[model samples]
Target: MQHAIAILDSGVGGLTVVKEIMRQLPQEKIIYFGDTARSPYGPRPADEVRLFTRQIVDYLAQFAPKMIVIACNTATAVALDDIRRHVGIPVVGVIHPGARAAIKSTRSGMIGVIGTEGTIRSGAYEQALKRISPGLQVFSLACPRLAPFVERGLFGADEAEDVVRSSLEPIMNVPMDCLILGCTHYPFLADAIGQVMGPGVKLISSADETAREVSAILYHKGLLSESADIPLHQFFCSGDPALFKQIAQTWLSEQISITPVIWQVPNIV
Candidate 1:
């Protein structure tokens, strides 16, 4: 059987990645999982994030995906290697692609990174950037409340603008010419962030870069879809399936079916 690319995030944020995938790899099948019940993995402990990511990976694995993509910045920062080592399938994450894109976009050698608390605190983007360009100056800020706002589907609201402006005010003073939206969820707020940062700064969305990486990987593995028919796309959420479905349809501009992945509470018989 031809397998699909499995993508997961802490919540609907992963759809950003999925959107790019559908656009870039229109022929490829996709299976996406959103851990919405435990959304906003940013503030959670690294171990907790890792545990949750592993559980989601295990669930996605049953589908026999050709590859797995951890579309969440916090999960990629905290749990990527662990999942890679544990899973039989090839695993991809957002940090390297976002870092590479930022490195390529910046002319001033100074770049800014905005992500969840876990991702920023992990220094994943900074480490990835410096690894590519040793002398580059990297500034990272953790926008803890930003993901929650997006997850709640508050992207265009005045409250979102206020939160985005306040969250980005510190980085606006920096002289960075390129900013990486390190969190997958952040792209939903890109307009508000772009307005606050103005046109001088180039904002790099991890979704776009990641989709490119996925294409490259699939090509190298000789796994690119060969079917002439439109590929199948599936979405699963661990929380509020109705809300997730509603937001996804609006965001992706398509009607979609969403299956809820209920986390069963273990019995203590």
Candidate 2:
């Protein structure tokens, strides 16, 4: 059996990263786990998020994947280094890739970052951005409501625009040239977010950059799949399978056409 790439998130938010992976590296197999029962890791305590991340990583270990991608920004901010210490395989997180993308896209040094409370509180993006370019002006906001909204599969509703507008009101007038959808889940609401942020601010999603990083790491390590045949992807969620399936199918269909195999794991909680 070919070694699969393991990706885990707090909920459907990580599907954004999965879509990018499927597009950029079609031959690679994916094993994804969504802790939908505990959908928003954003507001949780850092220690708790780290514990949940460790549990999920331990669960995915049975598959013996070649790499593990911590696709949730909240989890990435808190648990990334801990997971790396616990696992033997390569570990990737969405934070640095996102910071890198925002740096490249910004014409003005002012960049805005919106994420869950935990991500913004951790100061991870700000640190990552400053480490790359010392003089960057970074604005960070915690949009605590957005992730839960997307997790419920309501990102397409008319009310989504209103919610996005209200959530982003604080940063709307900032003269930033680009905004990082700091949470992976934010991409699900990209349409509403883009409309609110206007044309001048580029919306940078770590999904694309993270996918590129995954491909680069695999290539350098000689772990890229050599098979030409399409791979079957496995998805597992801890909450409502029907809802998770509905959102997954809707979002993934827009990117890559696939009939995903989804399972509900009740023991993770």
Q: Using lDDT as the measure, which candidate wins?
A: 2
For residues 50-98, could you state the per-residue lDDT of candidate 2 as single tens digits? 9999999999999999999999999999999999999889999999999
Which whole-number lDDT from 0 to 100 does residue 230 have in model 2?
80
Q: Which residue runs does candidate 2 get wrong by more than 4 Å? A: 255-257
lDDT computed for candidate 2: 0.93
TM-score of 2: 0.97
Clashing pairs in 2: none
Task: Give all candidates' CA lDDT scores.
Answer: 0.88, 0.93
**Tens digit of per-residue lDDT, candidate 1, span 10-107:** 99899999999988988878898888888889999999999999888887777899999999999999899999899887799999999988888889
